[model samples]
Target: MISKRKLYYLLSPSMRYSIRKIYYFPSDFWDLISGKRDKTIPPKGLIFIGPGDFKRIGEHYLNIFKEQCNLLPNHRVLDVGCGIGRIAIPLTNYLNKEGSYEGFDIVKNGIDWCQKNITQKNPNFKFTHIDLKNDLYNLKTEQTANNFVFPYQDSSFDLVVLTSVFTHMMPDDVVNYIKEINRVLKPNGKCLVTFFILNEESKNYMKSNSDFNFQYNFGDYSLMDKDVKEANIAFEEKFIFNCIKENNLTIEKTLYGFWSGRPKNESFDYQDTLILTK
Candidate 1:
């Protein structure tokens, strides 16, 4: 049995978007009529990313940013792949007027919704849509991710965040993004990111978890679906470390998430996390 996500990748982006709307229409309508959905949260149909409760996940990361990343009220932050303002929504409450946020994503609708909903209220938060082509999430754009330059000055951000971003990117694209992240980060700045790391132990766990579709293995990385390489991927530990070392970034902390069928309480986050410093 394959995962629903793998099945989703078998279709085009427009078909996937339509299916999502059809699948969530009943629950979204019920939430709206019952008033159970929080006013601040986006409509269920609009939240394409994330696994669980959006606000809860956002708040959970906020705590980690404060305690682990040492994010300050005046820190300038950058959020790559800021889908539908899920992460940005929580930060609006935490970041004062002194702090600012800038986010960008490949999906135009997500960025459009975010701009209309989140940016109008909080002028400090901004979102942009980049036309990058990805097999899993995007195909309409002809722009390639490997050479795309980030629209920011050098040493611009205090904290850079990329949650579940690298897992969907190819190896070359990931390296370029890492270099771009290093370039945009101020000296002594930190970046928090999540990945599905393939190691000896994780390989053993993958045997037990059928939901994870990292079956097509390359030397350093594995793909969930060969047809859609960006649908899901797991990287080798050495490959990840080598990229970090070569990119002028130093590891500050590493926490392996329980994605490999380990006890949920044993992990810090759902995916393997790393905090790197420039």
Candidate 2:
């Protein structure tokens, strides 16, 4: 069998990134064939997918944001990597007129959907399409993640969110984004971000059983599939903590996830949740 590292080197970067989509195509095709398609689902080419994932995961994170961070109806919010307005759709009814939402993503289709479907109906909710380069999704963009600055004024938001964002991001980019999140947040503002944290317990759990085990330690992080490094990245817990502290953000709370074989009652979502305050 060809080793993952050898296979990674054999394929071009684009191929390595795009091949993961092939794995999901069958499942996505079944969803379409079964007539389960909806406006919530992005087009097949633009799929960051899972059928019914938008509604289910959105509500799960929203509840955590509300409970742990004291998310208020009137607070200004920012949703980084706000794919297809999963969180924005629910917040449309939850947020009052005084509250406003700003979300940005590299994928044009998701942003366009949010603009037309969510923003047009609710003017306060806004979406921006950022052409940032990502090997897996937006390989054509000239802008790289490390240098891309978030378009927002200082101390602009009371709450900033990054659901499944950092999990795909490289370490430098993650650190840069954390700094931007810190700069834009108001004093005592909170950020709800999710990641696949590789700690002693989670690592041990992964060794025993888990569909996605990040076995390849690629320098700063671990990868489930070495060929597609960004498909699933798990960072060291200490590195993440250092990034938060270096950015001047304080961790308010942490809820471990069930992804590492933890019981459902003991965990939150599939990724570890960190509630950080600026």
Candidate 3:
């Protein structure tokens, strides 16, 4: 039996709707929070949550990730911070028998869930847990709990996708991950990263609303202008472009607002999808 405290914590109001929306299999409150569950599989080809309007959101992002990959039949792909095979599964289905896919994440439950629910009998799909604490990718010996390091050899993958992963990371963590991504990507390899950025449009939206007290950061994650108390510490276009330039990478293509629902403005949108290459 699960404890009431644990159950309540797992099903917090903020996450309850999202969890209930996605999971259909038997996931107790404990299982939801602990991310472990007994074996009782859903039918094959059936999305556990069933196809609905919400699934379209996932599909839209999947399409964006695929467009960024522009994958060849023989290309090897990497899905970093792959959450419960959301993107990884679709990418595998897209590749079919043509290409290979490897996904990595720090959370064991997510990998376990993917292994049981998403991994097909197909030999092309592989999933692994990356431990930054162990310096898995030979990343600097100083390992922090927040860092995620990939364990693949240099130039192993043709394409890497980090959809929505950097949105939750701090600025320092994003920079470290970018360096690690550059290390693993083959020469001429491409990467696509998504971010929740503060743009001129978002700033104006906040400013126009007298009730909303939000401010925008001026091209720096560390500093925020007055009235902006909480800014999403992800990448701004300028910051990301500078990082790419510093790393000697070329901007292959940049697609903005493809999946983000932010309102348009004179300067920018609230979200951006960037595609970079070396």
Output the number of the TM-score-best candidate.
1
Q: What RMSD does each model have against the real structure?
A: 1.4, 4.1, 8.4
Candidate 2: residue 192 Cα off by (Å)? 0.4
Candidate 2 lDDT by residue in tens digits, 119-139: 888999999999987655676
What stretches of model 2 exceed 4 Å from their correct place? 1-47, 50-52
How would you encode candidate 1's per-residue C-alpha lDDT over 1-278 as one tens digit per residue?
86667677779987887888898999999999998988787887877786698999999888989988999988999999888888899999989999999999998889999899889999999999999998877899888889989999999999999999999999999999999999999999999999999888888877899877488989989998899898788999999999999999999998989887766788888899999999
**Between candidates 1 and 2, the lDDT winner:** 1
Q: What is the TM-score (0 to 1) of candidate 1?
A: 0.96
**Shift of residue 157 alpha carbon in model 1, Å:** 0.5
Per-residue lDDT tens digits for candidate 3, residues 5-37, read: 335334433253345445643445456567564
- Using TM-score as the measure, name the better of candidate 1 and candidate 3: 1
Worst 10 residues of 3 by lDDT: 223-232
Per-candidate TM equals: 0.96, 0.84, 0.66
lDDT over C-alpha atoms for residue 182 of model 1: 98
